[model samples]
Target chain A: MASQPHSLSYVGCNFLRQRLVLSTLSGRPVKIRKIRAKEENPGLRDFEASFIRLIDKVTNGSRIEINQTGTTLYYQPGLLYGGVLEHDCSPHRSIGYYLESLLCLAPFMKHPLRIVLRGVTNDQVDPSVDVLKATALPLLKKFGIDGEGFELKITRRGMPPKGGGEVIFACPVRKVLRPIQSTDPGKIKRIRGTAYSVRVSPQIANRIVDSARSILNKFIPDIYIYTDHMKGTSSGKSPGFGLSLVAETTNGTFLGAELASNPQGQGTAVLPEELGLNCAKLLLEEIYRGGCVDSTNQSLVLLLMTLGQQDVSKVLLGPLSPYTIEFLRHLRSFFQIMFKIETKPSHEELQGGEKVLMTCVGIGFSNLSKTIK
Target chain B: ASESESDRKGIQNAPEKNVDGVEWAESKAVEDEDGGGDVENLLKEEEEYGEENDFSADTAGALKWKEDLTQKAAEAFLRQQQSAPNLRKLVYGTVAEDADEEDDADEELGGLFHVSRPDKESKQKANALDCSKFPVETPQDWDLDEVMNSIRDCFVTGKWEA
Candidate 1:
């Protein structure tokens, strides 16, 4: 090697392969050589000397030894090794201190190699307890090691009444090197709606089916409501009265109503709410206001209403029609008034069941007005 | 011979209908003529001739006759002691003594019977295998001791990264 370059770069290589590519700095190849036992790396030597001095100061001038062989370096702080630190400390904390030191020296390394820190104590307060407490997750993230690839294994040792033992903290350096992908989808193209399957109770199902059939039967008098309701309208002809009303426009075509009974003896109306309520609201608002609307607008409104009907069918007999909502509001107010009607003990004795009978009559009249509308 | 005569007389004097009737009478008459001599030899000759051709009375037949006599004698003894107190205990004691004697007789007979071995060499060869000499190999991938030591050091020394 004739006058090899002074600066050297570290690159992964297989010595047996007999191929070498030197890392270049300033348009020149740096010398690639391993540090010998006698000839230590200048930076490493400086670090050891400073670290030992600090330890000696902390330990009140106690002797400290730095053993270096090949690439391995060991530090032995005789009697004062653990004396400088608190007697009882978390192992994680100590490991965190080591990691912090490593991060400070990271810029000096020619090539970054993955560092694994294993074992931290949590079980009992022992010699290694400081290491366990020192290694906080936030501290690790600070060192650019916040990724799924970074792994940590912590061990806890038993003390005193239990037993003194070793704990481990393992932190793999791969986490810092791994790439992160964006989790968010960039733009909103079309709004997607969620679908929910609803079960209808038997009493409610029967009421809905009966009400729907009753409405459909009004269209074609002679035609059977259940059978004819399912049949398509005659060519170029609208469905008869009740059926036509039930077959409201949903997305340019009349969204047909499906009559199905679930396991619970309840009928279910299956329609997408997006096509039902939303479209229906838009269509009905335009239609009621006498605004000129295209066929698509009309169909979209109808589809939204049909979807609204499916959504409401689980609870109510009919779709969430404007009239139905108004009626419900009225009924709710009426019930509130009824609740406010105070009855003294004496009044109760005088009226007996007559007051109840009168309340029922009032409810019946209210329901009749709502139904007619 | 004289004792046999007395036994024949005793059977003849027994309730006539209970004298084992015609079939037993014939057997007894043949036994009396043969004088119970060489009964086993006669049975061996009969067996050599095959069971179908055997003319000598079967051992089973003799056992059955003995059983019948024993049952009759037991019944008679029980009847005689019907009025005695603790009759069950007395009967049980006598039965136990008889069982012990039978067991002793069976042991003697069993000792007299011997079976020859098939092969001495093969048996000895089968027992000669040394099971203790073969050593068991530890699994290559799993060094439990090293892992355990690592764990122990980590926990005791509070050093997590090694």
Candidate 2:
């Protein structure tokens, strides 16, 4: 179980999750040092500790070690022994922090991954679960990982700082990922979203929906933003309101944006009408940076493409995010795959911005540990 | 007084008059064509680039009027190499070099206690929060006529070109 061909070393803690997730998938050992080594109380923070513990829960035989000062972490990745799991994520960060990595590892697991994550479902820090469900699930389907078991359901709406949100995410395992060619993102046909208000005036949701529709009505008439106001235990521990918008294209592309009210008492109180209008504008910004996959799911799709059956895969993306750029570097270290990057300047008048054309041949990474039914 | 001082500093740093800012801007625009985009150019219309990578290596540079064969061949190879580097080396190769820079922040006080430097932005970045959401650097104003026209074709209500 401890066999490793080569151990890749990285410094700092910025991309700890990406390095660890890629290592676990590739079965490589990773050593990360100087984790806030300069700080007075240097070491991994509580949120990162929670993330490592969550990773430990999803896999078996994994070995993780941290120095006394928590300044260094050594991880020997084990097989993805995925099964039923539950995790209470730290409130310092949102659940989207952990869910991002889970989306990468779940498909290559020995068994289907079924996990109940409890934490802040919607916050300013991460892409909320609603946005992921609206955008990421369809992006995964493009790579042929679809099945009856693939679903992401938010059973309880949670907001920060005292988060009580609960989300159930399940995904089916795949022996080999299918190669994809997603070059053209068609014109948007309709816009759909959910305006969720918890422990707040239900009237607030209507106000959000109306203002958002007012902005979006100029483009398409098929805009429908549902107002969902959860109550009691399902509403979560705090009072909050937020909106998650998804614009669906004719070619089945989903571009998403979301905004959550400042968590109870953290910052300035946001108006429901303003939140809705701003969220709509944000969606337009996403569309301007048009790509087959939205900005948040760029790394996930790229990872899946790298693990696909040794065939060529091509994807057009908007400007690569800083996080995606780092992920690209990490993929080379673990899997020895470098994408052919071509900058595709926007050719059409009034298109959002420049696009990036990424092309690579998959290494044909197969799941050897999954049991055949 | 402070504002005037800064204005003087700005003028001192400005490029000489011989270098036309317009020509420099044009050359910068062409250079940015390699990676970044000029958002203002959306209204100037767009240019199409149809690059055929598969047939280029074998069929390209079939010319008799060219001089310096070695230089041309070298330039072609460099263009191809620039698109995709030695990816594995680019990642792990620089990591080993960066391992040395990590030790510079620890300044020992009196040979026993170590001092932490808050001035290093990299240190803050290394320990920053991990999130996937990429916020827009420059959000286009939706109310502007040109900005609105830029994304009009993305919607169903807009005109579609053949």
Candidate 3:
């Protein structure tokens, strides 16, 4: 590295995680200003601050500065020094929020990242740990980031508000990621799901399973919805129930949908049957969007594709989500990579909605921090 | 459908129509006759029999679209394909970066005036909550058989092509 790259500048608090993660990955400084500056309670939110601390934990000698009012932030990234660690993610946001970024940085670390993230595991907002475990892990495995050490285990169930959930995430560091060319999304062969209830009646889980199965059974006979009811200490501080469904395709693609009950005392209580039915419909909607990669993990797949070996990596995805659109622009800024986006209409009969074929040649981003054997 | 097709062709072959509007129709009819004359001669007996059975009520029935169904669908699909805006341009267009520049210019103006710009929508988007979930907007009514059948082939049990 001859000279430090110029810092990228941005405004506002939205996409703060993406900016920071890309800055760290690209080894470029970043200056973000006017974060909720005009709002009554101005400055960095607790979750954003917690996110910064986690980034600091994974990296060595990184310099981070925030202004007096906390509306401005400046970060100069350091080498990714991953190791065994634990982080208490802000309860304001779910652990999934932090885990999503960590998945991007994990493979490029100096050492394997074995961290325990404790916070809300399942909530109305954000992807749940259950869905990520079922979907994202498989996506990562396709990129050859698999071994006995690659695992995401949820030790406790947590809802929002007063979150007390815990989970362990571990990933192996790789020198470089393999380029992928997955276009064909095979038909869904089986549907597997989990209906989890914590500090709630055990019967709720069964009711959710029965209702969800009733909707999904119309398409396939191989449907299994497991009932997971945690007792005493494992159930987090809140009393809630949720259902997460994943449709497994024949070509190893997983599309997931989930619905969680409102946090205690936050909104009207949700019936298990109603939640199950709605979740099933959401899963159907996902199937309608039909792509090799589902919506929630679209950005992750794109990021991995950008950092792969210097060869063309193509993926068939559903319509680009707004977050992914922003991520694409950020990738252009950080890595100077632009994808060839082509809209593929459903030309065949009854194949669901339109799909986008994304193609990009990787920047050949190798993990320089990984110690050579 | 037939009217729109003729109107489109009429606009494209405007030079021929300049001589006479009726002459333009006669020319199109002659072209059609030249193209279909061979096929019509080969199936003349079956064509006469088909015309004999073509009751007026059948043309007005729900199955009317079945007339030239493949050609009509192909034309409609082509129209849709051509009308769709280029998605690559939409994502990488200067419009988005222009928004950022406009925000910066507004901020500069505010700095001089010592007053904040009240751009509600862009401001809200700048500070919006970040979540990865792409929520289903306007979810289809799954109970409807039509909607259910839309994604029927997505499952393994659906018909498989040999």
Candidate 4:
């Protein structure tokens, strides 16, 4: 059987050499010596409190390193231990502390020695078993400490009627301490834009649709520009007739102009001027307000405005300006209004009724166009 | 005619006499076993009344029933004995003697060896053992040195019971 390491000794009364023997799992021993005051032995410092504070500083990413004999030990972020220390001096000197220190120092144990500390309760008070129950097993698993080597011995230290304290010790299973790492992932990924989509409620959708229809109706109206005709049947010739003037709103800011002209015949034919300018102005306003522009609808709004101003008797047989046509095409789909007009030949002519109809259509189209835009 | 018959039968019976000087007829006849004729009957009647009035029998019976039930309680006891397998028995015998001798030798070795010298395997075994397995017992021989040594061994090995 192997003999236990020898205790420290002093040769003379003046000199005392205290030696500490730490053995590795391979049975190799490392000896450390510290000289102390002759009158009193060295007691433990306030390491317990300091250790607690130290562990508190360690977060998920913290690490500690200790170098011994050219070998570096690394302890990564994990569980920490905290406990009290007890000392015994009889045949030999020994120090006892909680196994918690080992846990805190586990990250630094590249060649750590397996050790144990034992103590009994010094008081009759209820034990704080919750701390042990909660932390012990998890710490063991985290540091990979073998269950067999980790020991906690508690005893009643004092006589009856008085209380004793508890002693806790943790030991590594292997002679050489193993490296550890935190299992927790550090951070979360960030998202851009609105981050999520919101669905429009039925109430909101209904309101939007109702407002769009109302605006469309106010911008376009149904009305007759003329009601009389005198024409040569064979030649299809009509006397020159005055054009009706009508105005419609484009976007929310500009008005579209229209002209209705008559053709050379007894019957009156109407030609309206296209309102591309007003549509462009309105489209620009919408763009300035940070809303998407429907170029097609803008052009159509311009077209209808200008065309409505044409003479009733004139025949518009050819295409208008390319710019006008393009503008009309762009505004075609976006207009909230549909123009409906009817012309009938009657012997009796209502005085200024055509102008009244033109004015009403103009006002209605402006209001509707403004609201929808 | 009734009065004449009465005078003929009792000769007017003599006038009735008062027994004041003697107490009552029953007291005067107390010396005789059967002189106090109705006294014994009166005592018998009183005893019967007492029996009818007293109702402690029911209470006494209840107490007795409770005591009987307690006395008949189920009882169980466990007794443990040293019964090791043959191999373990042999090992225990040899190890026990060796351990005893080694304990004695440990005292001499104290100055040469540090008590805290860590033994990984022994510590592991100690840690693995159930704390309740070895109970603390007062040894027949109180050796401070031996007790201290045992305590040190327990501390180093981290095993203790009871």
DockQ (C-alpha based) per candidate is 0.00, 0.32, 0.52, 0.00
lDDT of 4 by residue, A229-312 (tens): 222231111122111112111211111111112222323432211221222222122211111111112222222232222222
Whose TM-score is greatest here? 3
Error at A294, model 2, angstroms:
1.1
| Candidate 4: stretches off by over 4 Å | A1-34, A38-137, A146-179, A183-373, B1-162
lDDT of all the models against the reference?
0.25, 0.82, 0.87, 0.24
What TM-score would chain B receive for each of the candidates shown? 0.14, 0.34, 0.47, 0.17
lDDT by residue (tens digit), candidate 2, A270-331: 99999999999999899888888899999998999999999999999988887888888889
> Which one wins on lDDT?
3
iRMSD (Å), candidate 2: 3.3
Candidate 1 i-RMS: 44.8
A1-373 in candidate 1: lDDT tens per residue?
3553333222111110001100110112322122232222321333223333433332322332223432322222222111112122222222332333333222122222233332222111111222222222323343234455333332322222212223232233221121111111111111111111122222332233344443223222322222112122111111111111122211111111221212121234233222223222222221211111111122112211221211211110111222222222222322221111111121212111111000111111110111121
Error of 3 at A300 (Å): 0.5
- Cα deviation of A149, candidate 2, in Å: 0.8
Pairs that collide in candidate 3 are none
User: What global local distance difference test value does model 2 have?
Assistant: 0.82
Return the lDDT, model 1, position A200: 21
Instruction: Assess every candidate by TM-score.
Output: 0.14, 0.81, 0.85, 0.16
